[model samples]
Target: NTVPIYEGYAIPHAIQRIPLAGKDITEYLRGLLKERGYNFTTPAEIEIVRDIKERLCYVVHQNFDAVLKESVENTSIEKTYDLPDQRSIVVGNERFRCPEILFQPKHAGLEIEGVHKYAYDSIMKCDVDIRKDLFSNIILAGGTTLFEGIGERMWYEIHQLASSNNKIKVLAPPERKYSVWLGGSILAALSTF
Candidate 1:
């Protein structure tokens, strides 16, 4: 969920939560593995899937349809990931398709709005005077946001949703995965009380 902070306080505006998250992408990739004739019902297997997703999955900004079609043909876009058993699995479309859920949740059977819509909606719910500030200070902090191209894709999508005159700036720090913890530590260090 995207929270708008104003005047050093988080404003209780649009607090939207969706079923779409990092786990959803992992689950989607797991399903793909199953379709490829790989049986994985054990927790250990699930961990392997999660590891593969974290290590290899990435977002694609363009040619999504081409990637999907080419993936089926086992094109050059495919990557081989060696499992602990010395067997390797070919990964292709799953790389971008899984992350595509962030932009189009319906692709993963989720009925909720995409991240771009959520962010725009949240800013719209805020006062018009602060909408620009909200757009300028957009901070993306989460494990899911760490995927390569996620920040770029988000900026492109949100920019499309926002007015042309409104400057949209999304901040995705390198250490975004631990942003909440780091933020708390900073607050604690700066607190006089």
Candidate 2:
């Protein structure tokens, strides 16, 4: 295990990537729409599916099954979005389900494990002295992290997996998708660089 450095410090013994990514979530959304008989199979049609995700996807914290159950009994939980062709799609559980793959991969039909556990295991492999600091400063970056409530869900899941004694915090900047580049640019411009 080898942890990558962030802001100039190495995080030893913690460098494995969770295979899931933003594209995976896009594909998951595409598949969901297709399954609902939306016929978003063509390359062009898939773009519409991506738009749906950007506009509506958000993670749900805990009680995923219960929320799904409630969705079936309550039609109001769903939202409708207008397509370019003047048609519309009724988005239901797919909103939360799309992002849910990052949290509960298997429960969302993904073959891989959950990201929260991946994070927990990686942190556990680090030196005990900095584990608490690491846990309390978890940052979620990248386009996929743009999803609403993802940070909260991440904290919830990681907190559930981590020992109760340590405090956990997950932070996602407002411009998460660009924050990495922005940080790198700042670093490159610094005298230390």
Candidate 2 residue pairs in backbone clash: 3-14
lDDT for position 138 in model 2: 83
User: Lowest summed lDDT over 10 consecutive residues: which window, candidate 1?
Assistant: 11-20
TM-score of 2: 0.91
For all candidates, the clash counts are 0, 1
Off by over 4 Å in 1: 190-193
Candidate 1 lDDT over residue span 32-77, tens digit each: 7788787667899988888889988888876677768777877676
Tens-place lDDT digits, model 2, residues 108-162: 5778778788788888888788788878888777888888888889899998889
Give all candidate RMSDs, comma-separated.
Answer: 1.7, 2.2
TM-score of each: 0.92, 0.91
